[model samples]
Target chain A: MAHVVGPEVVKYACTCGLLKSISSLYFCRYCCQLRCGFCVCHEVDSHFCGKCCENLPSSEARLKKNRCGNCYICPSCQQELSTRIGSKGPSNPEDPKSTPKKMYYLSCLYCRWSSRDVGIPDQSAATGGWPDRENVNANRLQEIIEMYKAMVLAEKQQKEKDKKKQRGKYLSYTDRTGVTAAALRKRIGLPVDIQHSLLKAKPKEPEPAIAKEDVEDLPEELLTKPVNLTEVTTIEQRLLQIDLQPTTVEKLFPVHKQLSIKRSLRCRSCEHNVSKPEYNPNSVKFKIQLFAYYHVPEIRIVTVEPLRAGRPSELIIKFTNPTQHQTTITILSLVLSGDENEVKEETGDQPSLPQEKQPPSLSSQPSSLLSLSSRQPSITIKPRPVSQEVNADVAIPSSKVILPPRDDAAEYDDSGDTHNIQDDPKLVVWRKSNKAFVKLLVTPKQGLALNTEIVAGFTMQHIYTNTIATTVENREPDKHDHNIRVFLTLGNLVGFD
Target chain B: MSRNSIKILQGALVCEESKLRGDITIGTGTIIHPSATILAEAGPIIIGDCCLIEEQVKIIHRLPFDQQDKENTPVLIIGSHNVFEVDCHVEAPKIGNYNVFESKSFVGNKVTVTNGCIIGAGCKVTQEQILKENVIIYGHDCHMREGLDRPGLQTLQMETLSKMLPNYHHIRKPNKKN
Candidate 1:
């Protein structure tokens, strides 16, 4: 099962108009809509070292520039470097009783790059104490960043002063108090004007970089000497040391391994988490996973006859109800124009889905009001029209096929079929506990060239039972007919037989 | 040609599990780990002193195709203090002292390794060329660079393995005294 590759024969349309397979789509239970990766918001959940699997906090990771402290990568090949011990001979060759001293150096097992290759001295201990090189222009860059931050703060303060002056024209606080702020400051024996003093003590500005007209010429050796490509570093090697892109291979230094991140996805409209991974980096379990495969009806291509141009082909697709509730599947015609209108209406009706807050009851306590006031309004994204085009026509089935609820025990008890339910012989070819194979006649459009790819689309309407208990008095589950657009890529068209 | 053809000099440790074939002369103070293969297909192989050959290392001395018909079979001489790391395939015609062949590094018979050279792990040197002294071959592209100093010797590991291997595995008796 792990080796089985999925052939993208069926695709479901996402709410954001992106077509994706069911395995890639997520069903947001709060919004009760399908969301693809494009429509969801992704956030980094954790930062971890890929080599050691040590989880680092975001603050510590940021301080270390998002690199593992203990792990070092090869300067030449960027592979992980292992610590190797080298034994040095005794100081005096005549002293046969003396033991050799052990020295450790970082070495890459893959690329054979060792600290000794670049003239780096070996350390007495194994784990750390390797010297780290500081960027040459770090102090200059830090000063520039500080200067920009002060300048932006000064501009923001000026904007606020202008706004205050504008508001003062309507009603001045000095006029209402019958005294100016200067008088109050004078009475308190403080500085009369605070703005002037504060402005005079502004942060020092950094010197701007000046571009010179005269550029340095190329070295004399470059014109005379034959270039050795092996001695020069490639562009990729230079970029590995971002600060100083060394052109020569001698300047290469071991880089700290960068930390990896785990991501969590959230539905944009409902502000609900669609997928949230566990905090532990080693654990692959997720806290919340609302995949479409667990909520929507999965459709797989069973068999399809050879599609000929302008000829009808028998396309059999198996549909399985993944939800616990029994559902009735209705196959509707591919109404492109009608779907556009329905999407527009749903976008317009999204605001009305959230129920209005009821008036405060007479017996309500003050704490309840605090909770109600803290609730934030959910943001909804406008739905877009699906962009898929149907090239082949599907003959809609008149009768609706009903699927039973999934039962785990029924899989083990594979005795002769019981609880018989009559099904349409022409529509449903086979039926099991919760799976049904339906047959459809698909006709390729005429005038299509030979070997042209044929695509057929249909609207699948299934009964969805929302098990969420609302504030209403009734405890009954809310059942509504949900419609989804499904597209099937039939085989290429064949020439006339 | 025969099991007795292996010539182990004095103080050399040759494990019984090591596969030695044809006329092979192991120098003094050398340590041959178990499972290391030293095959002399066309001629004799003379390995120098203080060399460490680890497990799964293959050192084959086969004549080149163009030189196979020559009446004189040149001896493949590996210099002193050369280290053959685990799982490395070395078929170079000549190797100098203080050269380290890292794990899984393949040195074809067409190449010649000089003194103080280090072959990066998994590097394949098939181009017919001679590597200069203190030349280091590293990275995916087999980038070459000259080292400032020679790599440190594995004297401690050799000493430990020499004492430990003789206790667990059968050792070939040295054919010549020091």
Candidate 2:
């Protein structure tokens, strides 16, 4: 969360080979891998009007062309228009007791544009009854769609008739009688046209569009009249109408407000939702959010000395364990080539190794059968090699740094250190509840020009405790070390002091 | 040049907490709310009938930069049925009938507001220009557009405030007799 303000100094490599901050990555529990936005599948969960907060179903939204029915935006400024009431004076001047009639018109309170400005009459009712323009070519388009539907239906029926002819080859009762089905039907006193009547009527083919050689020439008035920019509509304004793109400002009409959508992300491999928002557009809460910041430890750069070419610089980085379990951190050398070997092993060994390792009794258990039937087979995508260039070498520390579990009560208590834990004083500079600062020595590569950005890389291996119980017998938490490649962009090299 | 002169005609209701200074004349059937200020720095201010000035409104009549040294000073006259909404600041030299200065609106001294004009809420009009009849200035960008009809009067709101304000606050007595 500290990286939300400034430039990204620390980046973690996702399983899909994209480098991103911890706040932007999602950790999938089923796959046990970090997923980025590029690798996950995104789907629109709901469509809602941003102004009215009214949610619309997908089918109804499609019917309205994905625009709100009641809301409208100003054609000039694109702001929401409010309906205002205008009172008309008495129609009969001699009638003293007559009351004024109220009429409503859509007006933009922001831009002061009203429906009356475009010569539109006011409406008696508030909601709806506004004039809606239809496309001039709508009838032609409808004819084309109906023609295509009929053509497809005719093609399908012809294919079925061909299949029926092929099936009648082995059954030769008609051939033995030296008569076809139509002749046998006639001899049996049934109607010869019964088959045609039984099938549905076939539609006639529609006329195709005709291309004419004569094109309309440019208007003669363009040569005499001076162009006014305000009267002519811009490209953006014309595109807003989409179907009827008016070129003049007077022809512009109020546009229906477009609907916004809420999206949900799913892990591609396991098909589990990584993030799913609530159905209600007003509710800001999420049903399931597997953010990597909640599952993995976060790393941030605390301080770094001025980096010079080929000179060693002291860099202090802070690591916070966000989990409830005590974790151990071990620093390893950055390996750019080892990822290819690991990917080869994963694809080559996964299929045969699972079948040979399971015992007969273990596979026959009722719980195992239940789990096997419920779980879908995962399709693991091949991991790409890390593409970071390490221009500086980091001295990997040998001792592992241990971080205590986070405590809610320890934050309030002002008492000094109570737990006695041994630590490597040289490597660990400072320690607090669930957080530790580690010291590292980085040496930039020599022969680099001045002002070149120095970027260092490393491998962070941390022990993760999986508390999820996959089987009835194994209730204990599984402790395993997970590795993530981290890269830090140290500031540009300064002149030698 | 008396600095604290205020003239309230018959049937005008001016709250005691309202700050008035320098040759200001309020017409009949006008209502001035508490904490509203009217200052005539270089000239006199004559407000017409049936006007409603709400709380925290400031109306100042100061001379322009070119006309500061003239012996004959022009008076800032605001016509009848005009509503000055809450927290508006009006420094316009002239405002005609049926004009509305909406809440938190600022009208600089350089602009002249004509009849049936509306300066919308939170609109700041500082450019030196003249607003034509029935012109509406609104939005964050100060967009100007011609309106078809003038805004309605707030007689009901004026009646309610006039009845309620006299009970709890002091009032300035009318000086002009009929």
Candidate 3:
């Protein structure tokens, strides 16, 4: 038995107890709060067109330019954009009566401003975006040279420290041949006596250039003889430590992360929001209303066939929408039997059936019936009136409100069988929809327990929004451990369960 | 530890909780005060071993907030055998080895001071950031705690060390001072 309560009897409590709602309610999953629209603050970081929203990688979204390659910008203003809303306001800034089209806008790299202020009538804005533009600064080359020089100096200091030597001296052939006495003395800051000693020890001589004919003539006899030049060389070749010059100090800059924003729905009246205005979760429009009084529902298992040699069999469900309006119902997934577990093990040893060789049209599943038309036509059984069995078979009024399947529902399959429905073994059915009647009859697979969640009294939107709120509430740290066992029983579908 | 043998180089004041790992090169007469920490969490800290480290120089090596769990642990390893004068703070959880920390210098958290890095005295490095392979940083001469917590407004006076130091593995012209 149930009792009806007045609106005053219901205390105003948000999904999270931080706030109260008298008339309407809404829930935010990210923040885990039930905030009134007026209380929440919205911030838009980066505005992007529809194409980038669908194609661009998340890493690329953080860049200053939102447009990808194979797109061009507006020729007049050199801005990348896409035309979205059209013909909404006044045309000219000065003229009062002229009508205007609310057009798309893009940012300018040079000016750091958008091109929406000056109406450019960009035809390419509909199909094009920014392309690769050349950088004009020429001084960038000079800066790079200075950077390379500094790197060389740091490496030399590290080598000396690693060797653990007190007075290690290293030199190259370039240093011995190219360095002049005066320049070497000035660079190393050696004393005048040492500088003179270095010059005196070196032999001042340049080899004479021989003509091509002379080399050809002398090569036969003179090339065979080894000439001893050690006696003519007065100074011994010595290695000196090269004094590395330290680079000038340069400033560093801090790094920041970039964020991107997307718009789903726009308002026609005031462009203040420019995107989807979130609705109150408790409103009637937001709710899922079920009208079950007019139609009859049936679940027909059209086909059942074996897949692997000894594994669990595949079952196909053919649900017919006999009513005039299209019926939307939820399939609470399928379950397998314990007895079939032995058969599943033997099938694993054998190689999987080659599914790719089949034709494209028949590639979905080999076990299930082709479509609803291929199965038997609608068989309408006479409705049973007033009986205890009828009351038990059909669930009472106001049971469940179904919402559109969430996006992350695909992660429900831990195995890669999310797309293939033949993998499941057990199937559950709902007895009633929003307090509407439900009837189930003979089917091949039986002995399954059905959990009929009878939702007392709530709008369609409230139930769906509450379902989302409940999921977020369980994700809190303290409740997460307890929820994990419940979530595992429901499988990988984290959002709904 | 002879009084006349060790020289006091450049470094900042540090805390007592500091831990030093790997091969560290400290300049003569550098002072390392109490409470400053250093963890050669990664490879080694190869200071020129001759440079001075001042007192209270906090040099630490710990991972940054974003890359902590994803990447390897902080390694404060130095190789530049620089001097540590009195009151120098040095903390590098992950030091690669061979980097030099001047007196009165401060470094904390996953700061990879690779070989050949020269940190000036009185310099404070906070925020789990990267100092790359070969980089040079000059400390602000005035105060040790100026502009420490201002987000996005921090002025980091750093330059590419490659421009000043030679590539450790490459065959190129060495620094004139070496």
lDDT of each: 0.80, 0.80, 0.31
Which has the greatest DockQ? 1
B1-178 in candidate 2: lDDT tens per residue? 5767788999899999999989999999899998999999978999999999999999999867987888788999999999999999999999999999999999999999999999999999988988888887777767666666787788999888788989989999999886
Query: Mind giving the per-residue lDDT tens digits that candidate 2 earns over A262-338?
Result: 87888765566889888788998899998888778889899999998888999999999888899999999988765
- Where model 2 places Cα greater than 4 Å from the true spot, the runs are A1-10, A51-54, A83-104, A146-232, A301-317, A336-338, A341-349, A352-395, A407-420, A426-431, A437-457, A488-497, B1-178
**What is candidate 3's DockQ?**
0.01
TM-score comparison, 2 vs 3, better candidate:
2
Model 1 bad stretches (over 4 Å): A1-7, A87-102, A155-203, A335-382, A403-421, A430-434, A469-477, B1-178
The DockQ scores of all candidates, in the order shown, are 0.34, 0.30, 0.01
DockQ of 1: 0.34
User: TM-score for all predictions?
Assistant: 0.69, 0.68, 0.20
TM-score of chain A, every prediction, order shown: 0.79, 0.79, 0.17
Worst ten in a row by lDDT for model 1 chain A:
A356-365
Candidate ranking under lDDT, highest first, comes to 2, 1, 3
Ranking by DockQ: 1, 2, 3
